[model samples]
Target: MYRSEFYVFDQDKPVPVIIRNYTQDDFDELIQIQSECFPPPFSSELWWNKEQLSNHVMRFPEGAICIEVDGILAGSLTGLCVDFDPNHMEHTWEEITDHGYIKNHNPSGDTLYIVDISVRPRFRKFGLGKLIMQAMYHVVIQKKLVRLLGGGRMPGYHKVADTLTPQQYLNKVIKGDLKDPVITFLLRCGRVQIGIVENYLEDEESCNYAALMEWKNPFNRT
Candidate 1:
């Protein structure tokens, strides 16, 4: 178990937060959290099912982590090891994450590819998502992986889709002229934008585009 303490904005004091590997018992809660995180436009059909969650913990327990505040399951971050080629990083979420089943997990892979990360809406003020991401970074270091990579959603894009192209919007976000809920948060967590990935997922807000981001393992000797 990976443990830490954090201060919740509305709480009186710091709460005990624990990051632990995904287990069979967390299936229902995990699905519930997914539903709350990605409601209507995000596609309920894409939510975590028994099969995918089972494969995640079974195939790579270390790559799947959940965070609890006090005692409530507040969020989760899931990933899979992959032999990623930085030069060819144009795959869709389904292709890279094996449709969230992680059936393509490579034990000897150089990168830890993040599939999903979400924090409960009520707990979003506590910086839990960043903490969960830090847990993934620890996993990357433990496994001696080269980096952590993921296709991040641009939920703030569609609001300006009529006025800005995806790339243009991304540029503004990077330059701090604009802030995207997902991309801005990821950027603050030490990830850098690689490029804009088209058709990365089916989210109307993003116009079906994703921001490819990566956090290099500075300590990696390879």
Candidate 2:
């Protein structure tokens, strides 16, 4: 087990727990977590379908992972180590756009994409998500990838709140709920946002925020 201060539980409270990667054998458990997290999450049957798995995110054999407490699925993430290829990413965006599925995007100097990071509702604020992200960051760095990327949304990407104004929009809206906690946490960890894609999700009206963050390893840059 990778023991660290991050994994240490608060003595005063019951810590939401369990973290590990997924195997082919974990298909069922993995599917269960997805269903709980997404609005219209992918079904286990859908995930297990051979055709879907081929095109699915986190294509690595061990890239798909889960966090569970006891026996129930808490959260899961699908990630991959890939070269920075604009053409390939654009191609993927084009194909998925045809089906109304927006691509989650972020770009770094051209190394790794921290594809997905999610924590279960009950598990939030407990530190598992950070643990997973920290782990992924190290793994990507070890591979000598230039940077890390991922996709996220602006506040109104789904539904705009009528109460908030433009100023409120930028501050409370954008900086508050509009901001992705994962991205915010990432930024706090020294990653710099390098790019943005406007109107990236909806029909040029509602905007989707695409951010790129880079963590340069001094040794690798040498």
Best candidate (score: lDDT) = 1
Off by over 4 Å in 2: 1-18, 40-59, 70-72, 85-110, 156-182, 199-206
lDDT per residue for candidate 2 within 20-57, as digits (tens), equals 66555566555555455543443343223333333233
Question: Residue-pair clashes per candidate, as listed?
Answer: 0, 1
Q: Write the per-residue lDDT of candidate 1 for residues 80-135, one digit (tens) a residue.
A: 99998878878899999999999999999999999999789988888989888988
Per-residue error for 218 in candidate 2, Å, reads: 4.6
lDDT of each: 0.90, 0.49
Which pairs of residues clash in candidate 2, taking residues 3 or more apart in a chain or in different chains?
Answer: 105-151
Q: Where does candidate 1 clash, by residue pair? A: none
lDDT of 2 at 30: 54
Best by TM-score: 1
Residue 18 error for model 1, in Å?
A: 1.0
How big is the positional error of residue 15 in model 2, measured in Å on the Cα after superposition? 4.5
